[model samples]
Target: MLSRSRALPAAVLMAALLGLSGCGDDTDEPTTTASDSAGATDSPTASTSPSETAAPSSARTDFCAQIPKPAIRTALYGAAIYDEAWAPGKDADVRGGVHAEGAEFGCAWTAKDGTTVTAWLFAAPVSADEGATLVKKAGAGCEHKKMRAPGADAAVTVQCISDDDTVTRTQALYGDAWLSCSLQTPGILTRLDRAADWCDAVREAALV
Candidate 1:
């Protein structure tokens, strides 16, 4: 079974990643085949087999398997008030495959204290280093900082909708997967730490 992500209200965490995709230029390469050429007049007219078809108009790709439930639970650290997993087909693969803006899978853990932690993996063209660079550059205007975990390429940035405590988000790239960790608590300092912890947990699980 597949499920939708339970994220912070659209006003907060959602906007935090708004500029991430736009930071880099659109590079979706168009897919074409020899029979797609206009000059190919002798191309077969018979309907193409489903397997031979190019990209499907609508299809689903499951990516939730990449995250381990036990790891996610452990990463939450504090009491987990909420947790969920998304099954395959809940979403489509990233554009241009798992290296663009198409595939998405994630799980989240909400603490009893109103602190929320979420992890995400987006298949994109950029390597782990490239993704880190983009996030660092894209978040230049925000309160951002680079973080290094033994086995993960990561960064952390804070964005608060209010003047007080807000959400802290950590991002990392593992292989071709873009991993994200978010924490929202009443204290900014705690949130930041939690976010980092989330990243570290993800790194340990992924690198293992």
Candidate 2:
């Protein structure tokens, strides 16, 4: 297994993977090196639902190209406010990121509001169970619920409450990839509704 060090700077930490439950703080996600997003235009794209990612190898690679950015935007109801690629810089973190020993690369999109969603692709050896645990730890507070999303091997929802602030994160681990969506608003019910929809749309997009 490769070593995964938590190297995300404070700015990027706000947007860590299942450590997901997306975008913690409100910093603009930095752009990935051109080489990282180079093959983003490849076609006949894996539209039939991507196979579960194999265990990651020690080698580093970028696999985000397999997913289309346009599709991602549509999945966010065309309300996506931010989109960025995850590379080996500030965005890398101990879990659910490029630094996670086997992550190829990842792409994320955030809605105009505080809804942050991320799709992480891993080619390393980490299992879906391990990935879910990382997300669980990241949301260690409000509520924990295990779910069954259409294409996911395993799914979970975490709600964290700090003072009057309540944030919810719903995530699903798909083989070598995991999708997480987060929302926090003054209206708790509103936050949950959008978070659920975001997670569902992304799951459908990935499965299609």
Number of the predicted model whose lDDT against the real structure is largest? 2
Residue 186, model 1: Cα distance from true site in angstroms: 1.7
- The lDDT, on a scale of 0 to 1, for candidate 1 is 0.39
* Residue-wise C-alpha lDDT for candidate 2, range 121-182, written one tens digit per residue: 33334455565454544443347755446666666676644333344556555654544444
Best by TM-score: 1
Evaluate all candidate structures by whole-model CA lDDT and list the values in order: 0.39, 0.41
Task: Candidate 2: list runs displaced more than 4 Å.
Answer: 1-78, 88-104, 111-114, 128-138, 146-148, 162-166, 184-193
TM-scores for all predictions = 0.52, 0.48
Residue 12, candidate 1: C-alpha displacement in angstroms: 12
Off by over 4 Å in 1: 1-77, 87-102, 128-133, 136-141, 152-156, 159-161, 190-192
Clash-forming residue pairs, model 2:
14-24, 17-20, 53-176, 55-124, 56-123, 56-124, 56-125
Per the 3 Å backbone cut-off, how many clashing residue pairs does candidate 1 have? 9
